[model samples]
Target: MTSLNEIPARTESVELEPLREDKKKIFEDILRYFETNQRGYIKVPTGWGKTFLSKHIMKKYYDEGKLMLFLVSKNNPLLSQAYYNRKKNQPLFPNSALLYSERRVDRKELAATLRALGQKKGEGFVLFASLQTILGKQSAEIKDLILKFTDLAIVDEIHNFINNRGNDFLNEFGERTKILGMTATPFQGVVGNVKFVDEIAGDMREIYTKTLPECILDNELAPLKYTIAESSEDIFEIFDFEKGLGELDRQDLFLDCSTPDRLKKVIRRTQLAKDVYDSMVKQRHAKTLVFCAPVRKRVYGVGGGDKEINAFHAKLTSSIFNGDISAKKLEKDIEPVLPVDFKNYTPEGKFRDAVFISSELPKDEQNAILAAFREMGKPPYVLCTVGMLIEGFDFPGLETLILLRPTLSMRLFEQQVGRVTRLSPISGKQQGSIFEISDSIDSLYQRFGEGVFSGEKVDQVQMLQPEIRLEELFSEGDAARAIEEGKIEIKKVELGLRGKGKGVKIKEVPVKLPPTSIRAKYFSRLLALTEEKDVGAFEREKRELMRAALKFRVRELRDAEELAKLAANVNKLKREAYEDRRLGDVSRQHKPKVFGEVEWLLKLQALNSLKYEGEHLSLQEKNRILKTLGFEPDFRKIDSHRLKCLKLGSAHKTIPELVKVLGFVSRLSSSETYQFLDKKKKEQWKRELLPAVYWGFCFIEDSPELKDLFESTEWDRRVKNIIRQK
Candidate 1:
């Protein structure tokens, strides 16, 4: 059984047992996300015990025996971790399984095993399986188990397999069960990546994110000593549109970097970077993991055609690059840079051609090799991969990291650097180290290392763009143009900005370009706009003005640029409201008579001639009706009909927000006087009019009607059909 201490970073919050303040905060955030039924990701630095926090929160939330945990993964690594924690937190999950690749278990066996432990309602039970096993091998059975029993599915690393694995689950499960996605970073790549994340888990609010610098400063992660080798100018020269690739190639860049010179430059810079780190860290660069440019075989297709290309991308991201270079040549480059003793290279611990894995080694030899490469005092002091080791993999001896992967993706770059940033659990190492081969990938080290500060006093966080794919490098982000083309919008932000201090003041901050589906653009634009003075619209209609003012008052609580754009979104919303009202108005005019929620529909029903709905009442004459109803009863003073019509129209003009406002007054038709109708007819009019009057005049909770329409249901479908027609 893994002890509670090992499972979660916690303490008894008292004098005898001190609490881990950071972990406590993180755990509380997780609890809030769950309590709110939120469905998004939270980020914690690599060494901030993210796994432990997950365990801690899971224990807290699973106090209800009704909870059935579903662990979603590609492999059993998380499953094993969960198993250990479950053991440590026994009775919390008395029934749990750890099914890995080598020892596979079918869903039947899994289901039976869980049921055996607890068949009663509220009995705690869980099943753990890799997404591959559940979605691929035991897909049908797992689906049955999920549909029949599972309540909440806790997915690990959604950013990884969400497009496919997540799609499979969502398609089968629908929205019948709830989902929780856990990851170190919330956002992934720019276009396709965010789309997938949004598809599976993006709808969920971003509960919390603990920045890397915070973790490092707090000693949860080691402080990184980052160094850049090649100047940005030299690095930029490789992708030089003027030198390496012509403007034509730049116009349409391929997945594989087309320019041979550029690829060679990447390789050379990578080698140089390795040599620098090896000299600095005292190794053959074996312990240093290098994140390289993603090596894909071909173009990435959205609908799944190029298999090998996809596999290469996945494999590169997984960090098992196996290739070698000339040892003699490698030594020649580094020998001049450092003294002879700068690196430790022996026959037994020599820098191998292929660093991460070599199938040539026997099982025991391979195990020992892995141990040495990962451990502090072992041979083969460096290792390398692409985006693979950014998260999940834990190794304390990985003291230094060399950045060979020239990337523009800020999130990817941060994640890669985060590899070595963790405070090694075993070594108690105080600092992590990073060597940049080239900082040309948009000044990777400078911006990340020294975060941009706005004011000396104001403490506010401005959002930054996380993903900058290589594709974006080829073209200018013309988001403003897109906005003009109606591809983007300056949405009115509903910031419940509360509390006050002369928050962040934006002075001379260059306004960021409009968001091109990139957070940087939105964040930048917002920061500038938030500092603006002009806030409200004076030209709006009464209802519009009232709502917009309410929205503005709420916004003033915080200092943000989004408030500046509030009127634009408000205007758009006002247009929509007007259109809905117009639809109802038009439907009334075209109708033959009046009566219901639509004033026009009600008017059609109400304006009937001799229209009492019954055998005896239907036969009543209009003169008799007028006399009995006491409506212009004398008939000679009957310019009274015009007077009654005027009165009804004026009454319906109030409460524009209430959709059926006119329906109540439309019932008071001059043509259909009520006095002559039989008792049954009067009763019928009262029966229907009472509800119609209630809908238009009364302020009921279901006034808007849209709130009651939960999409795809019959009522919602009907409302949408009416909206479309209108």
Candidate 2:
């Protein structure tokens, strides 16, 4: 077994070269960060092609004749995976060799191997080893080799190296060569004032920013539907090994705790997975992976001797390969103990599916099994393991994940969920499903709650929300026009009266003002009308207000001129009231300005009403409108019902008249015009129409006038869909 303390020393210096397009981008970014800051971290999410990027970095320095050392975990699976990934994709490092205790070639022999490869016209050499082998008996040779040849050190899973007092690897390695530590999780516990590189840090990296829910909605991964199994007691009770073995002596409890109970649970949860796999096999068969926990428990007999019990243990000691039995044959006897259901169950073999139960297998055997499985052209439908399938396993065909383990760590949860999110080669869709069976709903909620868990923050700014809202705001013709003409002014103003007091002598009175800006140009224009004497001028204002009330509005909605106009209007109106000759019947004398103000306010009110009506249409109603207009209800062509209604004039009170005008202007057929009239009667005509209205405005690509009508929105999905049809 490999111990954590004994890390091997890196010996060979490999010169690497850039190999792939994506790798080149990563290499440039890493080099740029290194040059400017001296140290930085690169966190490419698993399956984002980290190996290609690493090879590219190696090649860049190798071409410069600089020596580089690649440090990886001592596990055979990880080491072998890295070696093969480099060999197949990156041929520049032909001199790369594996370093493990079992294959411990002496220094002189290794030097010869290096020299042989060095003579092959390569830029550099790479020495691979387990960390235990490096720090143990091979320490002296490895240290000397590193001091002699190493220029740059690349440490994988660098997060594991922190906080160890005796481990001088980081300090010593940093003293000589540039140290780059790479890990999916970079932060350990809080250590004040320790400078380190981090690609993802703080609350920004949480699930809120990159949530599982959002991933499922976008079809980046399959959505998870959970089922809870009721338990009499906590599952942790079964794992309490500290209690005396005698406590489990009860026959009834023992029988209940047998393989049947556990198997039943597994069967219920995995039934869906099996069904999905079988369906895929029947149609277009594809590879799948399944993971299960180890089933090994120590049972103490009445005689006080402990015996290991496993589902496969009985099969290891008995075999009937031959009819004859001999004393010498007993030594090599082994039984074939398949799972209890294996005898009754038969795989159709339509989809090539195999099972690899990895509980007590030796490390080498486990690695060999995984390697063999990976090499298969049509591998197993399900690759099962305990913890092995959670990380470092990348398969693009993996489109479904079944989670039997319940975890509170969002990091671990996401990592496990990510196993099957790789894009499918056949469908070209990055999709997968996660099925979790657990009784702990609270645990699930807590794990995915409103804070950071497993190194990912849950408060990330929502990308879709902002983009969608922007698209909606700018999709309207008037809104877009105001934005393009720079007519919209979002600013704040203070309201105060400098000249008079009601029914009293004038006195110096100071007042504080509210801090808010006017956002709409029409509102600003209305405010300007307050400065004019004739209230009729305000009524004749051509601009329209999109929002309902100036009060209780967002600061972004107000403009400076609008604020000034409001203050001037109120002040002037008040003065006119006091200056009027009629005192007793003042209402009758100043009724004109009041009515004028009300008229302007009503126009603003009407515009707001139109906006509200536009938003109320349903998808079916919008679709009906499109169909009536002799256009197919193609979502990609026009996704918004609001925009459709606005185009058809079905959103406003005078929609019939408006539709007639549109028909005459466009010379639309009578049938098309009649269809537009019929569209208004559809249910949910308002709810779905708002988005359509916004999108339609955004889709008028060539018409600058129409384009100017939509300023705050972008030509995004909703608009693009409409534009595509146009």
Candidate 3:
């Protein structure tokens, strides 16, 4: 083992940006926060020089004889790889002990470097390692050397590690050191579950946040523009017999992207992009990164959605690696591709191989792909990937992002676009363009409308949309002419821009395409499906909201097929929204509310209704009682309050909630009244309280008052009591 004295440090070079204010501000802010704070976070978008910011902070502390531990999650080795590359290219970045994919020499250097940093008090050192490696399988000595030597830990991708594994590290770090957690999308971890950023970062005190637009204004990040294509729903619905094909979730996306029909669609679009960019933007094959969604199948057999559509898929996965048996079994349906993690299914319903097309590349292979893509003379000039390159993979030469897959998450959509948004020197990349193939995401379209084309001003930092320009790939007139003339059309759009800050915002703008131009008239087959909506905009939007709510309810119950089928047709959805009471037909007992809102009144009425027989109460009389309690009685709630047994309305709940509540209510004796009393014997927040005071799974959360009344002394043994009640 190398000892502390064996490590050598190169003379730390001068700062990468000695005079850049944007760079200086980050280091200074971190330093200021570190002075008094023990743990905090800094939020920075990707490609906004996070490495540069990290370098200045690390260098500042190292020079002052303070040791820093920069922990990056292994899942995102791109950060580690990125930092290492920076150290090689930028002279000012410090020599840190990087513990990711290490060669023998690299390991020796790390050990010796750590040993050296441990011994020297005045000499500064920064240790870089993944959370899993340091704490996952390391020996005690290695762990001790890391913990004891570090004064402050600057964690990149802070949200990534805010889980149980992250807690394991934080538990060890404790009060002995300070922590500066950094992430581009802050407060983005588990929404329902406990959040790590909230717990560790604590309101991001002493933090500086700048938007993509602001960064562009400072020339710290590249400017972006967007173009759109029609949704893939039409083709997939018509051709794909597979269930739940258009959902845009992982499995749906994977199945759509890898299939022959869909793959051909994506490949064609990519080629078109290359041809268009070459003719329009530059005289080159548009260097592109095509983000392909994976092809997926159930591990065991047919999936949940499969059963809904009566699809009993054949066994295709098992015995594949063994090779002969799986190949023979799936020979009819699947053709052999590279025996990588890709699978093929045939027209005859047979699967060819156990391979999966969209399965993630192993780290070694992923790193290799990244390395090759970085090479200027590589053949895969058009690199295709799924989820890996969304962030951290920095290829400035990448001029275009072809979003072949759809994403709903705004953060995800932004990160995918950011991949091409790097200003490149070697490839002479000036700006990154995003080709959105579908309107599957609202935030994406909204960003284009509000932030880009409409030029609507926004004040909030969160709303400081990146200065993106969106153009109609095919104008209405162009589409009409293309249809009439039987010609191809390529859609091009541009927006004029002006600089407001740092003289960088208006440095360059994409030129608008002129009418009567001789450019290729490229059109997607998807155009045929883009008929204007029959309903007016406001009515259509209202109907969609109602339709979405019902779909959400169906989804909560795991009714994938119903939701998928309902989502497929607009007219059908509109009819359902108008006709179904659970949707927006509010005249019915179960009135429409927000998607997740509980049908409290309707639910309680369905559970149990006991007639207050001793008092001769009218519907109006009982309605008074419910009104006194601040609940406006629907006629059902009032009438149900008068019944002795539970009403049948309880069956109306979505299946899961209905089943769970039924089971819970059945066990509760009719004699036990729910109580929420302030008395010492029965304090507030007791479990008996009919209105739920505690939060839990949405199903068993009952109404303020339950139903069912038992008049018999022994309910099961009461014939006389039953006769009297009747």
Tell me each candidate's TM-score.
0.48, 0.44, 0.52
Which lDDT values do the candidates have, in the order given? 0.40, 0.38, 0.42
User: Per-residue lDDT for 300-366 in model 1, tens only?
Assistant: 2222344333222222222222223322233445222211111123367664433543333355765
Ten-residue segment with the worst summed lDDT in candidate 3?
516-525
When 2 and 3 are scored with TM-score, the better candidate is 3
lDDT at position 626, candidate 2: 39
For model 3, how does the per-residue alpha-carbon lDDT over 1-726 read when each residue is reduced to its tens digit? Answer: 323233346575535456377567667877787777777777666777676667677777777777777778754455455345454553233555555435222454455566777786787767666676676444345566777777888888777665467756765765658887777655331111223354443333537766555555456666555554443344332123253312322222333333434433433433333333333454244566666544444222223443221111111221222132332233353333323223333357443322222224466654554565566644334455555566566678777766655443344555676677567778776667665444222232332222211111111111211211111112112222322332222333322223453211111233332211111110011111112222222222222222112112110112222232322333343334345634222322222221112223222322222122213346665454344323455547543342211222222334334444433433332324323323643332121222221111122223322222222222121111111211
**Which candidate leads in TM-score?**
3
Alpha-carbon shift of residue 708 in model 1 (angstroms) = 21
Error of 1 at 671 (Å): 48
Q: Order the candidate numbers by TM-score, best to worst.
A: 3, 1, 2
Highest lDDT against the true fold, candidate? 3
